[model samples]
Target: MSSARPDIVVAIDGPSGSGKSSTSRGVASRLGLRYLDTGAQFRAVTHWMLSHDVDLADPDAIAARAAEPQLQSGTDPLQPTITVDGEDVSVAIRGEAVTAAVSPVSAVPEVRARLLDLQRRIIGDGGIVVEGRDIGSVVAPDADVKVYLTADAAARAARRAAEEGGSDLAATQASLASRDQIDSGRATAPLVLADGAVHLDSTYLSLDEVIDKIVSLVP
Candidate 1:
């Protein structure tokens, strides 16, 4: 018998400030597909752990309760939303505090284990653009299309600073570098160019250009 039609999971992985979110959203919206910002899910969970007074340094403690928060991700690419325990945290999760805390929170094997199923569930019947640091490699290895978005450190920093309406460029670059180091070094599902995933560098490309490139890959 012929194998099942592969789910159209457009997995886009990238380091922080690499235009993964924008490209994924644009591609999803243009194609009328669901959008899943897996990174935002991680942020929401990390924010929950912080609010609950969980020790950020204690991986075991964090892991033991990783499933406590109810994370809900809105799939509309036009307006993807993330909430924890029914609380809207789309803005809260983007703050520097959450930014700094998310890397470690995500590094916990238990946390990944908990979110993995939820992510897959959200992608059910899978016609979606899922963006994260490891989506292609772990979350949906058989995704019909996979792209690893990236850019130079300077370019990535500038993009992030622009998003923040002008932050210190140096600081933003430093933070991105730090986050990249942590993410790449993490033992569980480290950021990587998934096997067979096409690498797209958005450093010099407009968002539309990058989105079109990904869309063209959708066969």
Candidate 2:
């Protein structure tokens, strides 16, 4: 613990592969605050739907069962966990299958509504770092520090491929691009930089550099 004030809340929003998870975890760990990966929450739900063989193509089908799964997100930055129906799915939710379905599942209004309430409940009283597409825009609009972290498409793709052990660079880039389009165009809380947020582009910045810059932004 750095002895910093614990009531501060940091909101980080960005497209996929922009290092939101890593950066948010680093900030929370450094400041001794809780960490919430809202993106992982969405992935957990999508994974459950896929596991249950839900008709993901039909919004009505997804909406009808959106509240069926019991989603729990552990807020520890060092060991953040997500479980669906008491099953620890921290690793399973990161699969390519869930990745492919997450956009559509997340775009469904009912799913977003359910998660938004959960996210807000987890963020109560601040002292946490929340990262997601809509964290700064909708989840924690009045966070003490709001950062819209991003990078060039090439950099983003390369980082994502590296994280996945190995992936087709061009394909990864294309997927990221497609996700950006869907996440940004959704009628619900689309991906966007919230007002008064500091835009930090990490195309050339090291992870520590990015963390340091964001940590400096704390009041």
Top candidate (TM-score): 2
Q: Give the TM-score of candidate 1.
A: 0.96
How much lDDT does each candidate structure score? 0.90, 0.94
Estimate candidate 1's alpha-carbon lDDT, on a 0 to 1 scale: 0.90
* Candidate 1 lDDT, 130-178, residue by residue in tens: 9999899999999999999999999999999999889999999999999
What does candidate 2's lDDT look like per residue over 79-150, in tens digits?
999999999999999998999999999999999999999999999988999999998889888888999999
Off by over 4 Å in 1: 1-6
TM-score of each: 0.96, 0.98
Best by lDDT: 2
Please report how far candidate 2 places residue 29 from its true position, in Å: 0.4
